[model samples]
Target: MDKIVLLPDLAKQDNFYQENYLLFLRRKLRAAKIPCQLYLINENTSDNESFVAINNLTDTYYLFDQILGINTLSNPLFLADLKIPTDLIPNFQDSRTDSVTFWQGEQRVLTVKLNKFGWVRQVVSYQSDCFIQDNYDVRGFKITTEYFDKYTSQVLKKEWFNNYGELIMTQQNSSIVIAANQRKRFRQATYNSELEIVKEFLLQHVDDKTLFIADTDPDTINLRLTLPEQFRFCFLITDSATVPVGQNIGRFHNIKYAFRTVSLRDDFLQIAPEVKQEDCQLITPVIEKANLSLSNKLVAKIIYWHTGEILPALIKDYLNQLLTIMSEQKDVELVIDATEVLQAVILQQLNLLIKDAGEKTKPAPINTPAVVNRVSCQTLAFQEEKKLMRQARIYLDTGTKSNFTLQLEALQAGIPQFARQSNGLITPEVNGDLVADNGALPEQLSLFLRSLDKWNNSVIENTRIIEQMKPSQVVEQWRELL
Candidate 1:
């Protein structure tokens, strides 16, 4: 059956709720190892605007513009009032099990923490007997049959026992911090396709670990409140991602992992392709098929950087710069000095940039204490590290600076991650992944590169951009001009 998705009651009233909800839904599902994606179906309509989410039951995809709505498409109320689609009728919603039946009694609002791991729902007004399915019926996006039968059995379902159903699993005790833009340069995005692909990709990659994200309120925040039970997490690191409405459903649902603290990995960043950060992973598949002129590799770097732990405003800007350069300059890498010292140089330059940011304003990275310990103490056998180095020898494509920096930093800093060298050498073991037996680490590493600019424009524009960007608009705006 196709799952239905909904904006949180508070988010329905607030336009700003989207971003936080996005991060919220992402972290919980990923942490629980549940196969899910936050589908943002932004529709360009004649009257106002709207974005709807549908769950993917299959491998099929759809464009957002094709969805139908009467009022300003952005309003969930307008959507709810509309007739249910005939095609969606067979989605298998059992009114008896799906909705809580209310007896003839005064309704009371209850704030129930649904998913034990960490999923929670904000106050919902209903009779005690009435069952309220968390936003599943409305905002959820479902892929067509092609999507379901194709990815279901193998990609998402196969891991059912390990990822989605684990009572508790061993975490690598290490972390991968990424930097990515909040937005992309592509004129149009195929909503369902991007979300599900990345969801599957992450499930196939990454080890057991909790995910903490920095975001805004409304859309992203309500996501926590709307998640169904069995979908919760150990912790949630949030900023804001909500959508406010005049009706004022309730306070934004906020939850922090009990013993978890946001740790500062670096005041800096990197990427994991589809394998690293969820932020870039979110847009990765969509960006891949788009006809944008940008080198898929370079944009991957931007996606990587955009997945970082710094200020998202910066990440957003850097992504724009990346796209601008990629669109105009047929070439992204202008050969500079090549040496093993390249990684060290890149790290030094990035540190210098963060130092400069301190001169102007007090900076704060996510304070994850446990994460700091893990980042400070990860290990690998000499043979394993050597094997990864050998694989690294095969996949590196460009930028001696970025490649060396990502891998060397992981090793030097004691992170489990690895990198590809400038020679197109892959060193997959250096990658810290168990999934990529075939592809190089570049695609994933590049995702980390753009983080500097994507998360904190002030720092990137003031420092890193001067070094990494080409001589063009790549140095410019979208709240990330660096």
Candidate 2:
């Protein structure tokens, strides 16, 4: 649907905030091509009218942007134009149900609450657009599109590719817009050698090969969304791969694709129209099983988590939220003595992340497959869960204490201390955003771990210390490779 989305900043904390909510929303929108008006709300969520008149309701994407630390008001443009006018500032109060507060002669307050930002709420009726977690699906043709026809190359929009044989598309627009209005220049530095190579490859191996060439590496994840909430894009595609039915994915650039082996020969023509609609419907019915296995939510979550690095701050935040959601479940214990399992996992894989990254001296980092496949992420996650389960069982055996503090004590007593230790050193690639790399400890959550310097070496540490240590070890190993 071609529409604008009005997203309000939804967070409550004691410190700084960010536009992560907005970034999360924009990523989903960009991937889905669900265009909408972006009303970036400040402390103004309680206009009530914003949530009111919620007509043409498609879906309201609510992104929870806490976990990773980011400054929400860091933009200079917003600092210049936005203001805190005292007159518009609202006075808030707790909305008690059946409160006898009158506005006029007939109006009696039914349901309304004063939120943290001093905003007023009245007649709260909300309609949410489908809430998608995030977009990690980068699947689609990434053409050398910026240049020649954008199907095969990264060319400037206008300066001149006239000498480069086939000009599929020239400028950004089809019309003759004046130079002042135009934002992109038509210029691609192709002398036909690039195309010559591709054509040769297609002709030689058309029947049996797959060529995966990307202008940019696809391994690194993009997580700069804590600020700007919208994605501006230019795109094209060359081939169409079927997106499973009932799934929502975002847009792409350079979408046009080429068929490797289709020709205008009589043999090809003989098979072209052979398959009838009757045959198509017969196979369509069987695709439901495959469609159910493809999950949009999983695609989004994995993308966001993997983008930052081995231990993304977004993931810890996500896990915390998951725990909150699952808090009522009596069986699922959130805390685990992460040390022993983590140490086992890291020790199991350290030979790969640390030893191999520096072993080879190519100017750019090469993909160390041995390190990458050391342990499947699923295994680590399950190990942590199993440890938590084992401890929770011990706690349950003692009459399943209901007190929160007592439960924490039970958890601490059960927390396993990791046996392996090292004066930690990590690779820079641990956090993906190369500059944010810190060799100290490792994972984003590692900062909250046991301090070896603080311990006298003889004192027993809390069980959570072990939880904090081993993940850091794995993180450090990855950092070493980075």
Candidate 3:
């Protein structure tokens, strides 16, 4: 049987699967024994064309925005042919679980509760069309969809309520709507090589104090540089390889730029903020107090002790205290000592609290290589190794393995040795060049290190393992280069 699929409009400001309604539908389909593949649309392209192509592969394909009636395919069935069971249809009453209460300082402004089903109900009541406006308000509640769209904008529809618990008005043309509508024109500027067109576009529409680019496409980077000096631009660097060339060329434009590196595999986003000497001093006490003698894992546990107990405000206060200490003492050693002391103290406290909690915690798990047995090795060459290493440059028994060794040596010399993973098992079946310079190796290696760092940080942040250990554990773990 051909597979069933659900394709999301990646260009859609919000992820389609993130919607509770779609999630509900997915569960229902799975329960009905329907195999569904989720295709994430990444490129900025025609949605209808993409869906049609995807539909050609699957027996049945459901477009995420099918409910919006936006698909312009020649096949009408593609738009409204989902055979979802009637019983599986969302019941607003049952799904009404969200509650929101708005407050004006000490005074309660309004309160509302609703769900995706409830929003759908309101949409249906207003119009018979299945396509729901991005935002609509029902009763005293406002409903909105959150997603990063092609314009890299977040749009919302809000409903206002009076203090008397009555619906005041539903604002359809909100700021988000204006921003969303303007994105198309702004995007056009990216394609125009003329600097004046791009400059004019920024002058008219780039009003935000900070602009965040979800992906670092070349066009987006071009537009980013057009912004006046007053605005701050924060770009989400997905991969070092994808970083636009000449990023530093526009440095003279007086733009303030910040970067937040994201690792999709590890699910980590780290803000790369410019740190000052004073800021370093502020964090010194926390590090100094931390017990450096303990294993890195143990230290991590102590730092994250009681995990959720550390409130954002408390962390802020700790940072403020560090800053205060730095301002008081100009001595760099004092600042370093303070950081070490603070680190030790925080870890020690966590250790004590965790011990009292009566729960055993273990170190975070690391990736391990498969064991190589003599028998397994004999048959390794016979296995379907060809299918596994298609992208890898395979090297046959060419002269001395010394050439491959030299390539590895070159890779290590250029890239950090700690960044690459060592392949423990040597299989005679796989005869491919391990290192292939497809003109992207350097960029890929940089990305690998970044992703490795992100993965390590995530593990440390979430687990109690060698929490006490230094941040350099990631380097040590991947020390063996392949």
Candidate 4:
């Protein structure tokens, strides 16, 4: 079987709670029966077992820091073994198992944070709410510890360690104070940055059989140019932001690029005119095809606002438009898709708007339809968002920035999406609508709500759009590139 190594951007410790984009690509490739392996370039606190448990990755991944004989310990690092000061006792302030605090009678002294693997992540000592020392660990092994200035509470000194508990590196006042024998007893080479270290490791370890698929991060882009020409490389371009500027990709031998959409490829070509059209292929990650089934009654009109910055004024403007639509259409309801913080603000604004509108108009009689709060908040989780999209009469794109993920999700859910202007994700009358003016948005949405046949036609059109990016079609595209 052929091996394909995926070089994604640095993995964060909080990746377990967030949407891991790299994990999506890895799963899609594996689903196609491709032998895929993930390679990390950063020092994540989670060990192999803990990382795989959360990420659902198999036994085919490598971490550069771990492979370099740093933070290689698999055992749990107990806080008791460190022997905390006798004066300070454990204080169970919070119910969280991953965090703990130690108090010296009435004064808070020390705090310790742990990973899900029960490994001590950081030990911080505080004097009168000012940090004195901060010791950080990776995978149950101490890696770096920083001492702060007592009076200023600024980082004064930092000590770096190896797997063997050796203080091989230290820094003071933003400069290396004591550093030597960094690669002692393991590999002979010593590097300045982690990127250089990973680049060297790849050159030394990967064979000709290894097909490298790297995200278009700056380090990986540099690696693409610096690596030996004989090595085969393919870049996964997810959007226009990742496209390299002013570089002739066609000049590189045994190198190709895979884009998720034609709009992205067109954007890339505008910048890198020298890039050959043949060197790039449109290959979307697996998008689960949704059946075009309309709801018997349209109750919700979803507006996804996850990708861009959350502005209350903008959200208020969108809600005002929705409120207008709701006033005329009784069955339609507003469902906002945003984070928890944004949700609170949106709900507050919507309530205020509804209240103001009620105050302006005369009180309704008892016999009329009881006043109903039509505005509600929704989540952007996969299944929940898919459900909301399918049940929605129309998806309103209200954010300033274009959200490619939500666009794909709406298409996969067989929903009609309304955007301000047609971009790479939206085609005027095909997959979604383009209502440039806010005044026209309510009118367009109201039209769709009144005409079930028109809405069903839009949903059917979504199937045609999604057919080009289905899992089977994407797998075949990958097969051709590989």
> Of models 2 and 4, which has the larger TM-score?
4
Per-residue C-alpha lDDT of model 1 across residues 63-84, encoded as one tens digit per residue: 2312221111121222233333
Off by more than 4 A, model 2 = 1-44, 47-109, 123-246, 250-482
Instruction: Give TM per candidate.
Output: 0.18, 0.18, 0.23, 0.71
Write the candidate numbers in order of decreasing TM-score: 4, 3, 2, 1
Highest-scoring model, TM-score: 4
lDDT of candidate 2 over 294-377, digit per residue (tens): 111121111111111223343333333323322322222223222344435433443443455567642222224332332223
State the displacement of the C-alpha of residue 179, model 4, in Å, after optimal TM-score superposition: 8.3
Whole-model lDDT per candidate: 0.26, 0.24, 0.27, 0.63
TM-score of 1: 0.18
Between candidates 3 and 4, which one is better according to lDDT?
4
Query: Candidate 4: lDDT over CA atoms?
Result: 0.63
Highest lDDT against the true fold, candidate: 4
Compared with the true structure, model 2 gives a TM-score of 0.18
lDDT of 4 at 318: 63
Root-mean-square deviation per candidate: 24.8, 26.1, 25.9, 5.8
